[model samples]
Target: MSVGLVVVSHSAKIAEGIVELAGQMAPGVRIRAAGGTDDGGLGTSFDLVMSAVVDADDGDGVVVMCDLGSAILTAETALDFLDDELRARVRIADAPIVEGAVAAAVAAEVGGALAEVVDAAEASAAASAMTSDQNSPEEAVESTSSDRRGSDLSSTTLPPSSERPEEPIGANATLINPSGLHARPAAEFVRLASTFDARITVNGVDAKSLLRIMGMGLGIGSSVRVEATGTQAQEAVDALTTLLASGFGE
Candidate 1:
């Protein structure tokens, strides 16, 4: 089963808007928005957050994303009131609300576990920061590796390819979709990349990260190099190249 998500914000519109954006990439994942007070004012509500946690939970666990300080406080207080069993499965992601929710939703949609979903959320911020700091793909990969290694909750890192000595499987494909690698197409590419038992890179960035793929800002007619290393390298490269050649079914 897929993990679920909850978006908690001080403004109802903000929370709902985030949900709408994330939902475009993850239509099947359950994403509940807990925004504003019960009276529809501009404040967080413990009751609203609590109910959202319950509604979003689907036995796989829930990742909660908060907008501001008070929203986090309300979510934390709500978690405190939950039973020990339920509380064990809930996590308050240390991430930006919009980016975190989108990343978490895409991870959950791809059947990631609870910890992986949390990692996706937290990594969103870290990836953005690194991209802004160093615009090179090598730097992005190094930053991701360092962050994943440092995080206590990160159980998964980029698949290892050091043991294999041969050259990685590679292919080049042009973006034919009118919108290029936007949110939805990027999410689809990431989802496909995650299914393989290989380390894949598109234009040198981690292929399995939704945020990294979108951050590349590829446009229509842009040529992308897809490469992979590991046992399933050929399959991963073939699948991705085929998808890109097909215009991502647009």
Candidate 2:
């Protein structure tokens, strides 16, 4: 079985809503909501957390995301009650509730291991932070070679279009779907980009990172330029550009 996810929140609606949102991108993975008290109040329930944990896990593992510090406490307490073997397979991620759950769900849906799911959840915040540097929509969403895969953040500027020469290294396509490169399409884009043996970037952000692509907020009618380098650079760029041209089959 694939890795599972559990969302812990003080409000039942919040937990359930996050599950529904994340589930859209990862229909194959099990995502359980452990929200509010057993009586349906605005308080964490250790019993509910424990039950969700058990239900979510299917031998692969479970990654739990919490909305608040106290919800984490409830999750930790619930974890303490699990058998030693199962407890060892579970992880409590220190990440945002909504973004982390979506990132983790996509990773798990793509068959990532337990640790990869946890990393994906934790990386969402950092990815979002990197995108926050943009001061305006007029700036081109681009990542320099140094900033690839979030290794550096010192530079977010791209060379002026007049100075940069067009080559076979990249291709440009327009977003045709109504939602554009939002979570669902972004996740699919990242999934396809991960298959290439090349370092790829779409509009300057890491193409293999779901949050990074989504953070750009590219919408319908927006232009998408994909660039890559390495063994499969040409193939990678072609495939991604074609996917964008297809409107992600939306």
Candidate 3:
């Protein structure tokens, strides 16, 4: 089931950062945010909250975490917005915001229950220096060690899986170079692309991305289109021509 996480925060910046962090923590999980930047504003309203909740998980169930009193109250108020059926599946969890997002990501990625993720988030916050100071020295030390261990695990963010719908192709990009696409040509193509505001994506039958591009084992005579969009999209044609002019890496 496709699960969506709705992160509600007082500040859009905080909500944005949490969503970005969640994307890193869990590659495929869908996370949505609803918030206001000003102080004293109650969290997401009933309509927005229900929309985010419904948008994220559909019928798969969503974990909603909010900040502060009115925000919490606001979430409670929003529940009435859900129909009896969706309401039954919705859960408004109370926890420290950022920690909740992280735990949610981990839980979503590891297939753990949402309840466990909420528990982790609350626990993490309670022991956080910004919050309660409830841990004993030994427990603190162990938690510190575990935290360090988590750091050692590669924190590199994976690129999102293809989310864009396919557009109809106007031309067949065939790899016609005798030498095929290699490091220099790939670099040249990427460098050419850096000049434009256009969004460029390279996908082969094998896959998309530079890593996958190289891994596709395009030995020579590869014809790949330098597709582009935006004001400088035409530049993609020029840039690609410059790179492909040499007939790819000879």
Candidate 4:
């Protein structure tokens, strides 16, 4: 079974709606919603959160996402009561509830382990915050470069597709998915990209970031430039190009 997810929100409707939205992209994952007081008022419920954590766990692990401060406190309290063994496999992610749930769900759907699922949720929040403040991809690359000082900079730091040298293994394909790289399709693309061992970029954006891919705003007929570097570079490029050409089974 895949890693499960628990969404804790002050409003039951908000929690359930996030679950439904994330579930659309990850049908195989079990995502539970814990929201509102036991009396059906808008507030956190320790019992509901505890029950959801138990129900969502399927041996793999569980990742919890919260909406507000008190919701996190409720989740933490629930976790405190879990058996030690089960508690070891669960995590409460500090992330935006909706985006984090979606990213975590997709990662789990693709067989990510406990830590990877939590990382996906937190990473999505970080990526969102960074992208929101930048006006263009160049600014993003610049930020990445500045941040990498004193750290290992890899070949993936190549300039945008327009300025990069000819890659031995790269391909371009037109989006055939009627909706193009919308939320579901983009998530699928990111999920597939993450499976490879190469550093890949699609049209200059990190291939494994859901937020970055969606930010491209690529629609039907948009040309996709996929390039990769590393042992699995060729395989990564070929698979992504084929998926793009196949319309992502839309």
Candidate 5:
């Protein structure tokens, strides 16, 4: 069966770089990312990660990779909850999320089978050895075997609406968490809101960045009220409500 690949990393840029380089090595595969945020958020949720995996796989089987150990465990836990059909299609790569993700994605994105592509990726990353300032790939690889809080600022930021609506709804959201809106919750919230066209502005000290949202620092069981108008208003609210009610499926 055709297989897809998922890459998880503390930094989306690192994850992307791996995929880009891997494409050079393996031009016949597919890959997708699940971690942090392009808009800039830290900490990715299992549901969101699963969503990314599902998106990349596109049927057949999929290989999953992660940067930090917690992310890997989170990925594993997420896999456990996936629908049996999708769960059957996914397998974790015994490799670095950064290097392995790119390698596997390059293979699968081009139409390679999941296992073969992952095996090939393992070989390639082993040979190439993704490196940081350190000459060894292990330095660049990061460790998925254990959890480490890297420099990812997992917080959300929302800039003042530059484009004012002709019809505006003065919507206000609260940070109900004991801590307030940090890391995991922010990532989950962003993932949920992305599904609908709701213009979600995470309100907090630095509420303009996706990373800020992830690291916003909301306390326990806090409520962050999000307001949006337009076609996606109601649907966005409902979807977010469901996600929040389930603890963002954490």
Candidate 6:
């Protein structure tokens, strides 16, 4: 089964509304809304969050997105009470509820693993912060690569430089779809990107990251540079270029 999502908020309407919005982008994913107190008041309820978590999990895992401090607290509390097996597969995402839920849902719908879904949710927050800071997509890509490199180095030894591709395989394509890289097309692009063993960038943002690709704000006729580095670099670049040239089948 694919990953699932639980949106927790203090207001029942807010939680349900987020679910509706995210569902539009991830029609096949299971998403549950947990909001308000058990008494139907405006507060997070442990029981409600717990039930939503249970309902969302379909054997893959569940990612929980919370609106605010108390909502997070409630979700965390519920997680603490879950069985060991279930608890091990759950995560509390530190991200903006609405954006995080949408990103997480799309990742889950695309069959992302639990960690990837959590990364998608957190990436929403990072993308927002980068936008506010007016960081260039190149800078964002560099930052992401640096962070990933650091994480990898911390866990394992890196391959020798000579074993790596010296130059990135690159190609250019123009966005032909009227709407450009919107949600659905962006999701499809990310899904395909994730299938390869290469690291790819589109106009200087992580190609496998849905939020980063969409954050490029690409529009019809916009030029896109697809670049990849790694064992499958050439194949990845070629495939992405072809997909873009086809307008993602729009």
Per-prediction tally of clashes:
0, 2, 9, 0, 47, 0
Off by over 4 Å in 4: 136-168
Question: Candidate 1, after superposition: displacement of residue 101 in Å?
Answer: 1.1
Model 3 C-alpha lDDT per residue in residues 22-128, reported as the tens digit of each score: 66656667788777633435445556666777777745667787877777776777777778887776677666777666656555555545565456455545434
**Residue 241 lDDT in candidate 3:** 56
Model 1's alpha-carbon lDDT is 0.92
Model 6: runs farther than 4 Å from truth?
A: 37-41, 135-165
Residues 119-139 of candidate 1 have per-residue lDDT tens digits of: 999999998876576657887
Q: What is the C-alpha lDDT of each candidate?
A: 0.92, 0.90, 0.60, 0.91, 0.58, 0.87
Cα lDDT for residue 36, candidate 6: 88
The TM-score that candidate 1 achieves is: 0.87
Q: List the pairs of residues colliding in candidate 1.
A: none
- Minimum summed lDDT over a 10-residue window in model 1 is located at 152-161
Task: Please give the lDDT score for candidate 4.
Answer: 0.91
What are the clashing pairs of model 6?
none
Which candidate would rank higher by TM-score, 3 or 5? 3
Ten-residue segment with the worst summed lDDT in candidate 6? Answer: 127-136
Which residue pairs show collisions in model 4? none
lDDT of 4 by residue, 1-250 (tens): 9999999999999999999999987889999999899988999999999999999999999999999999999999999999999999999998899889988998898899999999999998788876676677888788788888636656457467899664557899999888899788998898899999999999888998887788778999899999998889999999999999989888
Best by TM-score: 1
Against the true structure, what is each candidate's TM-score?
0.87, 0.85, 0.48, 0.85, 0.44, 0.78
Q: Encode model 6's per-residue lDDT on 1-250: one tens digit a residue.
A: 8899999999999999999988877888999999888888899998999999999999999999998898888888999999999999999998999879988988887788999999989889887666556576788898899999888876887679998657888999999998798777887788788889999999888887777777778999999999999889998998888888898767
Candidate 3: global Cα-lDDT? 0.60
Identify the runs in model 3 with alpha carbons over 4 angstroms from their true place: 37-43, 126-250
Could you give candidate 2's per-residue lDDT for residues 47-99 as a string of tens digits? 99999999999899999999999999989999999999999999999899999
Q: Pick the candidate with the highest lDDT.
A: 1
Query: Model 3, poorest ten-residue lDDT window?
Result: 204-213
